[model samples]
Target: MLHDAMWDDEFPHDPTICYLNHAAVAPWPKRAADAVSAFARENIHQGARDYPRWIQLEHRLRGQLQSLLNAPGKGDIALVKNTSEALSLVAMGLDWTEGDEVLISDQEFPSNRIPWQALEGRGVTVRQVNLDASDPEAALIAAMGPATRLLSISSVQYASGLRMDLERLGRACRERNILFCVDAIQSLGALPFDVQAIDCDFAMADGHKWLLGPEGLGVFYCRREARDRLKLTQFGWHMVEAMGDYDREDWTPASTARRFEPGSPNTLAQHALSASLELLLEVGIQRIQEALQQRTAYLLQSISSIPGARILSPSAPERRAGIVTFTISGCPNAWLFQQLKDGGIVCAERGGGIRWSPHFYTSQQVLDNALAILRNALQHYNRSR
Candidate 1:
């Protein structure tokens, strides 16, 4: 039997603020905070005596990340600074030729778009597929041509809350033989992800968002076969197999995904991230899946009952994850966002609307309170006209 995973017993704090923006930076679970605090205290007390233990913690983190992405091996995982660095590793590592093309969605976050756009200097072309179309998959598949070297996409769109059929896209890429890369920052910890299922060559996510950890650390997964295929654009002593041997005269990039990590690991962020993943693992991804589905459904139901509010996130359960977006008919999105912000209901403005992303730990009462605030905010907007 799956463990009884609903562990929300209330975080030890004021407990009044409603954080509905896991899509953005998430509030760390208390366990993760306590872990970081303990590690900090240890640093001040023991110095580097147990520093080897921290390295072991980092190795354990790689194992958990390997499980998270469902990669074939922990050898496929690289500890990069953040999503941008991982994206950059792929961007600069590619062997691009003049007229070679890369495909991405129109709704891509800048991290996913700008790196590919930088390839213009190599005479490569970047194509943005419109995911807002009636048939997004067809539109993306049709965008590829003989010159298409890669198809990069976000597993779940950052804004608009559009979750793509990654399996279909992966199969299409497999048939066409185009390298598939996924910017999984939005989906990795929020839902189940599998590189084998998606047939992706690479996938990456930072720890700050749904992983519920600190910034400055992230995971990058490169398939074992693709490890050497990517050109290494960055190089340093730490990425070598003889990482600690400063006297080595000859060296080579690590055959494993460590080739991408060109420096010392972020031990600080790793402890916090490992702590966060422990909670998610303890609760089980299956349970989080059901909880998020229930929360999103409840949010949609609450918003639809309001007369002038328009839900921009998908109403279909499978098409949604933790994010719910909506707009007030005549209200400026900025105004609604500010009102919600001032009201202490935390979310964001995305897809030209207000987006609310609640985690599984979020209570029904908190959401109901947020919904009440939304209704009041919208009612004021409705009246000001």
Candidate 2:
């Protein structure tokens, strides 16, 4: 279990600002910033003196991702730019036939939708399942036709914060012999994820959201058996075996998942993310999960108490992770968002409501103050209307 003192040290002492937007770019952990700072100082003082140490750190990050995702092997994980790029690898790599169908949710983030849609030129079809149904899983399963070759979905809906039952979906996909892909950007760090249990073929997530790291670097998990089936679309020296041997003209793509890696690594982002992953590992996933649940419960209790406010997210605990979205009756979402912004409340506008996302380390006082400001803004909006 995580001690309160351990999590409390993460929030820098900002007197007036309330930051509850971990579903977006999280405020980096203290250790992460310190790691970057130390790296900068090392570069300023001595150039490339510790290059070998940096390579070791990158390897460590890969190992951490292996443990975090419970991948079949470390070779299944590829360090990529973001979820979009990883998903594109599968989209373009797959041998698609005309009339082949891909199943996805109507509410999928653009990343999941656009890549499959890009295949329209090849005469591939994209089937969208409605999640508003009582049984979302059943709806998605029913939409799979004989022509359906793959299913891609976000583990959690970005705006509504609705978590899907990945295990159940994975089972259904296996039964149908369809390829399973998950865009886990929203739930990767906020909730516990085990790819082996889910039996997914491909899974990817960006490090920025929920992972508390910099943008432009993400983790992509490809099942070892599935790695050989997909043809490589992008090629570079890094993607080849015996990559450093420029003298050898005879080379082949790596037999491992590293074949997806196109170019040189992002060493800077690696240090920062390495530090962030270290914090999560130290806290442990179960403890971090508990903190998020407690904070979200408290937020729901306080937000529901205010007048003219209605919760837009799922009310049941099983249906949610760490996001709580609400809408005030009299205010436009844009207006309320701007008001909250001006009042130093960091949040987002999504799903026709104001979204508040807090990480495990958010203090109760920040939530209380932000809620109070929101209520005042709502009351003023009511009077003016």
Candidate 3:
């Protein structure tokens, strides 16, 4: 059980600002900031003197990402610049024929939807399924046709905070011989995610969101058996099987998912992201998930008691992640969002509502303060309207 006392030193957020926007770019942990500072100092004084050690840090990051995703091995993990790049690798690498279809939810962020849509130039069709049904997974599975080659969906809906049944979707895709891909940016750090249990062929997520890392680093997981399914779209010395063998005339792409990475490593970002993952690992994702659930439940209950408040996120606990979205009558989403911002409640206007995403370390006082702000703002706007 994590108490607020445990997080006193980790997140020293501004006293005037109640930051609840972890679903967006997150503030780095103090340890991550410290690591970045040390790396900057080392680079300033003795550049490349510890290059070998930096390589070790990259290896450590790979192992950490592999463990977090419950991947079969470290080789299955590739460090990509962001989730968009990883999704493009899959969308472009796969061989598609005319009329071959790809299935995705209508609620996906542009990162998940646009990649497959780009395939339309190759004669592949992108099918968007509505996930507003009681059984969203069943709706997706039922939408698959004979020509449906892949099914890609977000692990959690970004705007609505709807957590999908990845395991069931993966199983359905496997039985149908269709590849399943998950954009896990929203759930990777907020909850416990198991690629093996879900049996997904591919998963990608940026570290900046719930992982509390920098913006440029992300992890891409490709199952061992599925590694060869996507052909190489990029090539460079770093991705060669014999990475440093400059004298070799013949070369092969790496057997591992490293084949997706085709350039120099982001060493600077590695130091920061590794430290963030270390903090998450030390705290344990299961406990973090529990704390996040508690926060969401509290927010939902409080918002429900507020007159004319409409909760846009799922009402059932099992269907939610760390996001709680709501709209107050008489206050347009845009107007209410600005009012909350004015009150120092950090959140976003998404899906026609104000979305509040609180992490595990968020204090109950912060939640109450944010609610009070929202309540007052709603009343003011209601009177004006």
The model with the greatest lDDT is 3
TM-score of each: 0.97, 0.97, 0.98
The C-alpha local distance difference test score for the whole of candidate 3 amounts to: 0.92
Candidate 3 lDDT tens digits, 1-385: 2466876798986878999999988889999999999999999999999999999999999999988899989999999999999999999988889999999999999999999999999999999999999999999999998999999999999999999989899899999999999999999989999999999999999999999999999999998898898988888988989988999999999998888889999998999999999989988999999899889988999999998889989978779999998887766788888999999999988988889999998888888889888888877887886
Flag clash pairs in model 1.
none
Q: What is the C-alpha RMSD of each candidate to the true structure, in Å?
A: 2.0, 1.5, 1.1
How well does candidate 3 score on lDDT at residue 111? 99
lDDT of 2 by residue, 282-359 (tens): 877777788888888888888898877799878777788888999977678999899999989989998889889988
Give the C-alpha miss distance for residue 87 in model 3, angstroms.
0.5
Q: How accurate is candidate 2 locally (lDDT)?
A: 0.88
Query: For model 3, where is the 10-residue window of minimal lDDT?
Result: 1-10
Question: By the TM-score metric, which is better: model 1 or model 3?
Answer: 3
Q: Tens digit of lDDT per residue, candidate 1, span 114-221? A: 999999989999999888777798999999899999999998888877888899999999999999999999888889889999999999999999899999999999
RMSD of 3: 1.1
